[model samples]
Target chain A: MESRALGTGLNLLAFSPAILIYVYTFPYFYANINLAVLVLIAVLPVVKLLVPKRYSSSVYPVALIIAMLLVIATLFYLINPSRYYYLEIFSIPLALSTFFAIDFAFAFIFIFEGLLSKRSSRMIGYLFLSLGTMLYELSIIAAMHEFSLTFMNALSLVFSLEILSYYELFVYGYQKFLPMANFQIQINQELLVLFIISTIAIVFSIYLRENGHQRERLGDLAYSLFAGSIMGTLLFAVYDYFSYTQYQLSIIGFGVLATFVAISRTSRKEKNRKPKIK
Target chain B: MIRKTGYIVLGIIAGGLLESLFIGYDYYIVALMILFFVAASDIISFNTGLSRSIRNVEVRREIESNSARKFQMRPIRIFFTNRTRKTVYFHYYDTLSDVFNTEGDFQGYIILKPGEQTKREYSIASIAIGKYKVGPVIIYAEDPMKLCISSYTAPVIDEMIVSPALSDIYTQRSERLSNMKFTYGIHYSQKIGQGYNFYGIRPYNESDDTKYIAWSRYGILNGEDIYIKQMEEERQIDVFFVVDYGIGMNQGTRQKRMYDFVIATVMNASYSIVKNHDGVGYIINSSKYDYFIPAKKSQEPIRKFEQTISEIRPNGDFSIFQTFSRIKRDVKKNALVFVITPFSYPESFRKGTRKEFETNKKVSLFILDPYDFMEKRKDDVYSALMKNSGLKHYRYLTALSKFFNSIGIKSSVSREKDLLYRIMAAYRYGKLTNEGA
Candidate 1:
């Protein structure tokens, strides 16, 4: 029972950065309405966690799809929130559910990978999942600075959780004793690294703005929140590097080559993989 | 077919078109970059995966024996080799004949690398006789993320036959019979014959041979009547087994019937009589074919016997008498005839035995009860909850037995436990008591 509580706590911790960034998008949403939407966003996931997967898995996906469709409809119709307050409120969860949907997909992979327990096959599964999941973030790009930061947050968390959970280290009591070939599992100091990386990024972004990179009223608060969401989402590639020693040689994949590879997003050729059996 | 990844990609394209139409060119660049990423990573992997079809996976199935004893466990091994240079992951299921009960797994998931070989092994046993066709393995090769699928069925089936097992029952019984144990029914009474093995002395009768009179006992008796020396006959017992098969005896099946027990019983008896130098042969009366082997002493007839009984011939007979009369010429004059039938038509049995008796041929009847083999029992010796049909068969057979007694033909209804014992004993008594005549 206590382990179950710890597992849920870690889960909440895992989702916190996206929540902070999502709630940040809506400081302009009006105070009482912002509070109402925040409660709704926060409470829905908690309710999902409390309910059984048989009930919750179907409910969340259906709700997420409907919200996504409605938000798209609002965009096409130009639903002016001053005229239609409900449409405005609906858009709030839509922004946050972008995080919800991607996280939900990973949740499936985490559980399924453990059951399958074959590393190369899992890598094969994740290769497609990571590539497919990135499309949602790319599709949501709205020319807003907030969307850019939120996109980074979602992508980072997807890969980070992928790294942490792949080795069976994410679940509270689960162990990685199952026989798998060519699977390199390393210790992850992610929360610590995420804290340091976010601190450095916030200061760096502030310095860039001071040096006149700023074209908008992007303040210290926005930079800090965006940095926090970044820690929540992207370039934990250092964390990624440290966590998988075999992938460390790809550090030679740093600088121009690494940038090209990450930006171009090509498939990596891994050698001497263990044969997978079901 | 559109894979899961394909659906996600299409959804992205739709979102890209809508966002570019409504919002601006700002997020358009990001969507393009992501789209380019998807095209690069996925299409390359997808193309390579699609090229390696599941047909390239070779499967070989092996069983140690072409024939297994009934209810004996046999191990089966299946080796899977990837003939293609590419690694392939697939789910395989080896379909087994329903008569078999698998002792371990026969189906699971596995991945084979280029030129890699792996084998899965399991054991299965059948409480049945005759041939079992075990496999034509079904395989589905799935791409890494289950993004694409291909299936192939390997035509890898093999057949194994199961025949009834005859243990050392014959060896033990034949040895004891040769030692002259008077083991017919429960009667332990000894019989006198003309051969050389000495038996106890008996009072001389008018028919006693004068050369066999006991002189020492006569001297001791002095003025008393003469006594004669009796001897145990060492002659081969000629036994002919008439095994009934047809709708009357059993519904057609190779095993799990009273007929299978009768086959086992006859095989045991024939083998025992052969060990004792007795001439033994059988006639299987099926619907369209009558498998007949003439009485002979050596094991040469046993091989033919095995081959005949191994086949699933549908037995045909108008009556037990027809089977008896059909092969009566092959039956030795003094051969004790053993007829094994379910006696479904009791009148047919009565008529059959009456015809044989008129010809002055001594015969033994074994009325098989199909109910004894069909019912499941918790305790070893007792019958299970007796069904009404079973009761009717039992009552009818019991009445028929009494009628056989009235007509002077000695017979017993077959029960599984005592059936072999009874046949062995009847052959012994028939040989001991009738060898001289």
Candidate 2:
């Protein structure tokens, strides 16, 4: 079989049994798999064919998009239970976790192919996409649980402040913009666990792919993924802290310090020495 | 950096507006965090510098010049040292002159660890005669992400002398030389001079050295009379290379220029003639520069001739006719002259040949076929232009060659590939034909 086909087949074989278990355990999920979900899944192959061959290798972004949309749709149904006949299935944390775990598996495959191909950009893009999708799912979870207005405001304020803080780190601005005061916000442990699991899966895939008997070794992929994951987790923590406590600049300030440490660790990965010329 | 940062700011604002309109503050916070993470990664990458680890760089060439008969593989080695604490990833390449036909890798990436040195080796073949400088190594350093790059040049220059490509044409050239009766064999000049062959006996004269007093002949003529043996003096021919360096002569690709072929032919011919103890000289004519080396029978003149030819660049503005017209008075009678040019200009061909013929010299009009040196046409408008110009040049060259043949002047058309054979043939034909003599 062609390498891409083999990769896809191997990936499906590795994760399909887990998905089957999830479907069998939750009989409601079978009924809840709506026309929209089926259509989205069917569109994956079509999108892959439409894109150029060079970009067809990574199918995770498409799967992740579908998963994110399903989670958001589920949250929307929770807001208005009458709007969705299968609203109870959407609200189940187990079902949501299962969907996220499947998305995480696809993300692992995406990163695996990227490392094997030596395309650093693809790996970085997958990381960013996963982080964004997970954060969006977190917000949906918070909204579904009927968080207070002050908590929602703090989440939004700290989110924007975090962006501005990172922007200030790279770009010089003429004037400084102060952040709003923070309010108490609670952490969603279930969502946090899912995000961490996905991050670990992505990193582990990179490590495993590098260790495979490939002609060229991508030793740096594991280290970069590890450092990027730490940075991502630290960013999540800072967002949580800023949302739960008073909106002091020190919240984002401490996050930047942690980011420096993560970056330093990433740089510590050993570089391959120049080989002797034959 | 500014562009990516601006896009992120714009995205944040758009996300903020969307959150305020429909989704609550929670959605906006999540969107901002995502953007912040991306921006933070980029910021960290931007601050990461590629350490100044390259402390020294050096390049060495194996063979300076190839022998006449075979192609010489010139091995080049590039050495660089990294002295910084961090690993440095950089790309480096060596600059080469057009005279070389390079094989193997000239440009490659190097991953240098802290306090380590590395060397890369490659080989190139000298395809033409020239003096060329082979380097000032260019190095480009990039971060692990390849986000930003820093470039530096190491001014490590080495000189390469690519002498004229020589082949085993000695036997063929000698055979051709032997076939020419005027050039070799029992040709009598009627002058008793320094020679190996006997001519006749003459009375001992005041100017005759005692060495030539033919003691046996004196004894045969009796003690009362002394006689000298007269030996036939071999005619020492002076070969002159009248090279046209006009702008029209530069009509070819950089790698296979007509001027280069002409130089190679002239250098090889000079080497052959000097090997046989004949005087060789050259006259280079261009609008900007004109040089003349008088004919002399020695190894020194041949060395100077080859050196001068190697340095000649094709940028002449003057016509070949004008150069010949000016040098007509200096050309001696009965001398062998090879007019090397790409007879592109018909007027120059007519006037130059007429001037050389008027000087009573044995002129061989060697036309370097420019169409042979021209690059092959691809399906393009520029290719059409080249095709049209090439056709016109071909027509002019054919007509010129016919005219020279009709007028009984020895002429031959040569391409860069078989220039040496054509030159030797022209020399043989010019020497054997006693038309001007």
Candidate 3:
């Protein structure tokens, strides 16, 4: 009970910045992903308590959708619909850079907590995910030339406060589902997910449909697809810094590089474990 | 091998393909970072020795008793210890055969933190009679992503026999026997001897040891021929079981077979006869295994009877006629021959069996039908037809029994459950009437 009360108190403390951001960016209040994240932090820890027992299974997804919609609608009630994207309404490149840099620095700690210790904390994973997302946002922003710092201070503060609130929420929310975490893994979820990615590889395989008529072999097509994905291990770190999201060649280049190294390492371990015949 | 991790690796490759498609959107890098994160998770965990830990997880099973009675429930306990420094969350499964029905969970996810030891328990009942094997505990570890798994099949297996409750069956047999009518205390056999009960008179023969000449008979004979009084000689009856061990005898489900009940009948009757100090013997013949024990009034034959039934896998061809022919020679004169069979034999079997043992006036034939001992068939047209055919077959066997009885051989056509009562009654009736012979 004490921990839950502390969690709710910390959550509200972090959520107070959203009210300030609303007031500071008033009259032309611009919506942003960080603002949506603020709404995400406000909603999750409270949904289970408010929702009735009968519809308990649908409560989390419903809360997430409601939070996203409310943040977007409230922030940009008077804005033009034509320019809705990941970038800020008063886009500032340096502020964006600092945000991503902090994320990149935190990601190493996240990896240590999850991978090395083998007790992958979900809160840390979400924090690392936020930084990778920051990297994603920076790539697009660098492509566009016009930049400003009009609403940077307010937005940056809101994002920092959003991160704090998320920590409080994730810690509290995940504990309730810790016993159910293994059960949450639908035994066939991996199969369906793998199928979708395999379909993408098949569609992008140039070797298979080379020049419409001259067919290349499946082995070669597979070779190119995998060779491309492996090139992706160092693919994201550089691709984002160059703002390659706006580049013409970046698609064919980076797409081929990251074909698949995930299957590569795990598959090797499996083969090593198999018993050899005498 | 059972928890195939190879498919999971294929799953991760598919994620990589989705990452490639994300190049159309700037978010493709986000997908790439996730793939990279999972790959590193797998590699680093392997390096940190989780793989070694999973292989070292130990499982041990302890069963209370090696043998259980049919329809009797027994508890099983399994101990698991995580010897590794890292915690493991793995699926624990204990494989059981179809004959066993478990009362508690046999497979589920279990958590064992570093150096933690725990035990799980479940109860199982064997619904049928036979020996059954259980276990070879399989535990497989997977990270939350399930990208890789380390499985260990523990080298643990135990076997137990599910036979009819022996003590209960004997107890029921004892209760049923005390109420049975005896045929004259059985120690006094009315034959011409110098024992107890008087027999009329016979002319004195060279081999006769005359304790006293009958004076009344001498007066009647007027000294023309010497006469001696005869007394009944004391004797006991010996029973030999001629059992069928053919493929035909093994009808019904794997658990409750026709031959299983036949063995029950033979065991009960043999026990009763042996208890009364009458020598009991048996002959079980088939192409696969042939065994015959001659009449002996002791506890040893009863023990052998049980051991053989438990071990015998009833298979191969058996001819009741041939077994009876063998019995005719193996059994002693005037000893009762008890034949238990499940075959709906041809006309020749009846003729041949009667020719072999009926003239000796000491044979009892029991024809057991499997359908009478097994569970009923399903409620469908095909089963209805089969049940009809079974009825006709049973009537034919009963008619055959009547023919054998008409010719002076004590015969019964029924199921294994009823054979015990019939065999016991036949033995007692044989003892009661043997005085005339």
Candidate 4:
């Protein structure tokens, strides 16, 4: 019973930042959805307390499914705005869905990291989940504005790819450190690409010179970075060609770099790793 | 501690720089202010020492150890009180030892108002017999934003002992042996008197009761006999359980050990003897410690005997012979001494039994078969080597048993799985043989 309460509290802590961000940046969106999210959050703990102890474990998954359904419905509503006649009532569901989607995402990430992982710390998990959610929201907003018929359609295509690729990146990052955030103020895309290529060259030369003795750490990092940069460049070039935009290419490049780093880091086996203290 | 909100603020500052350089918007300051407020609130909360205030607060834990049963769920309660003026988010986790099988619900979190007290309850069960420590409650405190998280370890720990489950041998044996005469207690004298059982006829004496005179026997003897009827006497028996707490006794898997089986057997026997209105005692010998409880009748002694056994660990360095030699002088003449051991050291065991026999003390050795108690591993080279070693040990145990039989000493080998049944059968056999003699 105590553990259940702790899990719930930690999940709430993870979800709060996302909700606060939504309310502050998008008040109009927040106004529509605040009631539903608040009620669900408040009622969840009460429902856990009121239910028979035998059925307590069922609460989390059930709440998660409900929140997912709300998000899906809101996405559908956003896709077709002209179909609903009762704008006020339709707006409520739309707001509620959007709120739950972001909230549930953070909560699930925290649960996965803290309870199910080999290590118990949730700090890395929180970082990736937060960044992923932010990127996802940014993609949605970018797609909402119709720059042109062809450009808008291309943005949607990129958004779908970002969802799949970034979600995978988040999962990988939760397991191990990917070193994606170098804290560079100005992201230089051409310079990053050149560095990745040069690093791959140097790593290949070292591998040949050392007979693959350093394959576990340095070799894996170089190969993954090289592969990820090429993929990111291809994706950004395709999107830019259709949408006629070049400014957002750096963001896409960074996202791809992070993804590949995560993939490479997760693939290597960590021998004699210590269990993380909570 | 700054969390993802800090990242958003940094992103906004970068976005503002980009907007000024390229697509300038007049109301960018409004967006910046909103992000700034969110980040500032988190930073302020962290800098204000919210976590420190929570650590300074006191916590108390309470649980009932006696109510816990072997292989049964028992509930434990913990209480946390917040004396600070600030409202705090608190999480507490109570660590459980491997001896218990429990669900992952022994921790909780709560937002306590100032001076608020809360009690949390969790359930746990003992899956094996042994003593366990459940404690050092880990406490975590943070503000609502979770910007600054601090943890404190409360040095409070509690110990719980799970005794083995008692068997029904006591009640069953007492009923079966009600007709037999037990000549161990002071209450019933063996001499014919006012006891229930009829002994035989004897010539009437001055002290003989008139009511006990067998008129029929006297008539059959043509009045020259003048005999009185004698009856068997009932008496209390003193039972001493001599336990060997050696390292070898600790053999076997984590779920079941030879020492565990030995403790269970001794506890069951003690319960049966004490239940039958007899005095019970114990002689526990370990490497660093030795405990001796003289045989005494009553409920308090039985409880103490169980408590002591539950806390005992296997650490004996001295051989069985040395342990017995030290406690041999304390054994009463007519008292029934039960030596419960795995007989890991055969030579020491033989020597100890011989010494006890020489002293004329009625001793029975209940040997736990170590081979049977050992863990059966999966098919591997290590397991095969262990199997070969076990076979050799079994051969030695057989030889020891035969030696005891030839020397006219009572002994029995009990498997770990059927320890209780074997102990009961041995006790019944011993009673039957003593009665027959």
Q: Return the top candidate by DockQ.
A: 2
Q: What tens digits encode model 1's per-residue C-alpha lDDT throughout A156-251? A: 543443454345533432222211111211211332343234333322322232212322223423443443334323323442334334442233
Per-residue C-alpha lDDT of model 4 across residues B235-270, encoded as one tens digit per residue: 556667778777767787767777766766666566
**What lDDT tens digits, residue by residue, belong to model 2 across residues B1-437?**
22332233334433432332122233233333443444345335533545334433333334434332224677777777776776666778887776667787678888777777787788877665555667767776543333333455666667665555545223225545542432344233444577777877788888888888877766565666888877766565677888887777766675666666676567667766666566777888777668778888765665676666565556656575565564576766456777877755655434334434454566777777777777885769878888799787777777777777666667776667777667666555544443222
Candidate 2 scores an fnat of 0.06
TM-score for predicted model 4 compared with the true structure? 0.46
Judge candidate 4 against the unseen true structure and give its global Cα lDDT, from 0 to 1: 0.53
Tens-place lDDT per residue, model 3, B1-437, is 21233233334333433433332232334344444434334333443345556677888888898777766889999988998876666778898877688887678777788899998998888765556678877776553333345666677887767666574356225566553333326655555667777877878777777675776676565657778888876567788888787777767775666766776667767776766767877788776768888778886776676666555556787776577667766665568888888764463454544345433537788888656655565778767877887898888888878877876777788765567778877887766666213
TM-score of each: 0.46, 0.56, 0.54, 0.46
Clashing pairs in 1: A153-A233, A156-A233, A156-A234, B286-B315, B286-B316, B287-B314, B287-B315, B287-B316
Docking class of 4: incorrect
Displacement of the residue B425 alpha carbon in candidate 3, Å: 3.8
lDDT of 4 by residue, A69-95 (tens): 656665666677576333324333544
Number of the candidate with higher lDDT, 2 or 4: 2
| All DockQ scores | 0.02, 0.06, 0.03, 0.02
lDDT of 2 at A273: 39
